[model samples]
Target chain A: MNSLEFYVDHLFRKYKASIQIQDLRFEVLGNLEAKVADLTANGVGYDEAVRMAKENLPSIDHLIDGNRTIYINQFRLEYVQITLLYMVIGWIVAMPLQFIRTGFIHWLFLISSAIIGVVYLVLLANRKNINMQKIKAFNLNAVFDLRKQVWLVWFIFIGMSIFITTALQFGSNIWFFRPVDISGPYQFAMIAIKYLIPFASIIVPVIFHIAPKLIMKYEVGENDGYKE
Target chain B: MGDNSISRDIIRGHIDAIILRVLCEGDNYGYEIIKAIAKNSDGKYELKEPSLYTSLKRLETQKLISSYWGDESQGGRRKYYKVTSLGEEAYEKSLADWKIAKDLIDKLIERQD
Candidate 1:
């Protein structure tokens, strides 16, 4: 296992599944191979050393993916907070567009738009909240376990959203303003309003949500307090 | 460390200096460095693989050591390392530090025997 390229080729066939190394993760593998060679310097042969090296290198994806689950779960917590805040804020703003002005037709558009915003937030949260456990349940071959709390989280979320939205729909304070005709520009505005909040949630959190997890997953084990 | 308890760590920290001192005039690999350490200390000192590799990585990171490929009939390929100019400076510093420490220790440990 002295020459890393030669050692990797030999070990790749022995792993049972044919895998192509896709990422820049070969450096870690190389360093591990070097360690294996060093260990067997006096005892095992080169072939044995290579086998040991491969055994030591569990899936890089699993190692990084497990860490990613933790980051994303926390990110979802932040996202859920922001999304709930947005809904509260949207309702405050749409109140003016609804009861204050009391346009006859604005009530229909307002309620529908708010429904869409709340639904979008719940759906996005559900998708991203998938923890490693569910990922394992989905794929049994997973070498690493994702944090378990995320599954309970999404269930609670969907259950709460269902309860809240249904309660709001049947609430006692059903004050309908004058019905606005949602057939022309009002229809288009309604459609835009439905999608706008969701789009912002997706885009704003895209950078925070995607970048930190990628960096964490592919971490080189910097000397941070974390075990990595 | 030559089985001496008191100055072991101080001597161990100079492993780079000791290896580079041997490799200064010639390129050497791992086993060669281990053998040189043993020989210099009259078979009293030895370097474990972890110590050797850790020092190598540390030196390389500091640009004080450079490595190249070596072909061998027994092994497929080995990385042969040489001390760089920066490594020479590190070796000199290690030597001076050791010399100062040795003088102070000898003075303290000296007896009328």
Candidate 2:
């Protein structure tokens, strides 16, 4: 309603609405109003009273740090879970495709998927400890900078994928060039599709896992910000 | 009346205790608490709102004080804080501690002759 009230509300704009936060906000706003009322009653002008009240308010950093730990932890857990879910989904989609083309399930594909699944479970189990480490290592500036470079990370990943696919296709003398007796464009295309399915299954998960960490690494430097 | 940084830092450390002492007189809301501090100090000290809120939260977390919404008839409902029994004990402990510290500091800093 007044300048003090507006400023207090603005400060907490980013926080999600919850009972605890709402209670804190209500308490803070009431205090600011009372301070302004008292100051103005004592002959201080409304503008000066508002300014003094605002100046007395504590920094948002301390307030957020004290109150938002649980919310931040839940967000981090969800981020990890979603990333792992994408990996699992990639494997699930690839497994049947591989079987349909090759006439048999790929053992390597199955094993790697199981490994990634296990890693996912282990990460989930140790999430609390990992979250504590993350909080300790967090740098606000670095995180913002890392977020800005996300597009570059994806571009590099796509480039690497193209290079790997091209090398495997030609270097083995398989897809683009094959033995004269067995060579045919149809067979070459089918083989390339089969290999590409497996390659994608692996690469997609690897990229999903590495992209965020890569950004974190670039921002905070290797072995310094996050240990695992 | 002088706003020296060192004195302010010392006062900040005892903000929770100072707040508890204010509550001992009567239950007060946020603004009233600040006014009480200013009144008690004869306008010599004014606790900033941020530090005051932080200390209030810390005290609430420690269970030394409790807060509740007051049913104001107009404007907005105000939140009032009351010192718990635990807070009273803490206040006494902090007061004694301050006295000892004050006496010790005076002795240490007093000019010779």
Candidate 3:
């Protein structure tokens, strides 16, 4: 019976519980236990009975159909919203520094920020259509297993950023830290890129590491509300 | 077993109807309903647990049935499902539709010779 519960739980591990989902879970476990019991009573061994009971059920994909689509759409929305937020925040943070040091804000960065903001608003407005596309494209299993890989990528990103930045800061005559001889737009471009690199290196990794888990936590909370 | 796949595909199309017909006999919990279907088919057909719940959910959403948790003195608590008046009407309609489909298919596919 415990094994029966384990099997059903494993199949649904990716899904968050709602009232309907919870009821369905218990119903599935109860039916599976009954099937196993009947099979065992008819002289089938315990392990075989469990296996047969599992085999009699349909695939998890077939079972999840509609409910799973809701979660997938939510996940995609969270991913896009978080990415846009990070981009906007990155540009805003860089703006003040550019103004304070260079006596003017960089137009390129400001324009990029505006573009990102527009994109974010468009996404918010057309979320339903985007979600439909996502339902067809996103792989739920990969998203469920993403937290660990996200962390690993974050670590590698941080390590590489630190190594490159340290080498640039200390290495003899590295253009990154050296005083620029040019006096026009080329100089501004160089300084902007140099400043942007370290900021991006620090910020992008942190966002990558944190965003998925944040979305997952929000999904769990949303589902928790539906629990009876 | 080889022919079971093709038959199962045909059965899959009417899983909801089949489940509703079982509940038409009496209110039943998940396991009992599954067993009844299997028993009636002489073990030739067995609905998978997930598929059963999935159909049950669709039926519930359509207001064809309602469910309640059963208090079992032993083992785990069970969720029982009862057919709604709406469900009984849907079941009858589904049965009538199936008969028409079955007869049409039989006539169209049968050998004249």
Candidate 4:
């Protein structure tokens, strides 16, 4: 690696690896390299060109767009908590499906869901252990990006619920040596609605609405300031 | 354009506009834009790396300019920025506004003699 690339990498070492950050790093290194090339072309020594290039970059803080920074580890932990909570909700909604099939698998799923919920609660209790040094700049775009992901998650959750519940209703009957029952239109419609009851887990995305608030809680206090 | 600190501060505030003005001529990359600014100012002003990048990013986010990576034909892949139609309109508006401001300031700060 060239001196300019090394210098730029050293400056960026503290920030987490992300697509946006990687792009920024590429842009910064390319520009510095170009500057050094220009100076060296003008009869300047290679080492002096590197020094001048480094000097030209007074600070990179302004290039990172955000007035406030948040502890990235804590923010990630929040997403994990959110995922576990959704699992608990899904499994809870699926619990009632046990009445329809009457099986050991349903009991296992219900127990596992309870365990996941308990794990989420425990993580929430111990979140104070997260390091304060892992910082990420906070911006409104991040919130919007998160909302988009949450919407996708909800979409997948609902789609899977419909699929699983329908599979359980039809597939289980055949699994136990029973015929695939397609009675009348009325019975079919009733069964469809009955199996799709797990869609009630749609309430999980409500956490998405509250996610911005949760993220705000992990923001580094103004007094702590972002370390360079 | 002058040695006056106040003038330099005013120029700094309009770095976005200045960068836009350069792109209005043709699409360019980061180092080239900095060089163009320095050359236009007769080497009087050299834009700092941080300020140039920050302005470029802000302008991109504002939809004033869009960027793409050029192929590795030259020296590696350089990010070239092009002005959008929206950017052209913004540059015109800012140029007009600066003209009026310049006129008013000249009138207000005229020598008493």
What interface RMSD does every candidate have? 8.2, 8.2, 7.3, 4.7
Give the Cα-based TM-score of candidate 1 against the true structure.
Answer: 0.39
lDDT tens digits, residue span B1-113, model 4? 45676667777789999999999999998999999999988988877776788789889999999998877666545889999999999999999999999999998999767
lDDT of 4 by residue, A1-228 (tens): 767777888888756778778888888877878888899999999999999988877446545655346777777667667766666665665676666563344565566567766766776776777564677665645666777887788888788877777687777876787888787996786687665665554545665666677667777663243221
Going through the candidates in the order shown, the clash numbers are 7, 2, 2, 0
Alpha-carbon RMSD, each predicted model: 13.8, 14.6, 13.8, 9.1
Alpha-carbon lDDT of model 2: 0.68
Of 1 and 2, the candidate ranking higher by DockQ = 2
Selected candidate, larger DockQ, 1 vs 4? 4
Q: What TM-score, to 2 decimals, does candidate 3 have?
A: 0.52
> What DockQ does each prediction reach against the true complex?
0.05, 0.22, 0.21, 0.24
Docking class of 3: incorrect
Total colliding residue pairs, candidate 3: 2
Rank order by DockQ, top first? Answer: 4, 2, 3, 1
Q: List the residue pairs that clash in candidate 4.
A: none
Clashing pairs in 3: A56-B48, A57-B48
Q: lDDT score, residue A215, model 4? A: 63
Off by over 4 Å in 1: A1-228, B111-113
Report the C-alpha lDDT of model 1 over A9-104, residue by residue, as the tens digit: 453432333222322134344355555667687688877776665554433333221222233343444544554554455455545545334442
Q: What is the TM-score of each candidate against the true structure?
A: 0.39, 0.54, 0.52, 0.54
Per-model lDDT:
0.52, 0.68, 0.68, 0.75
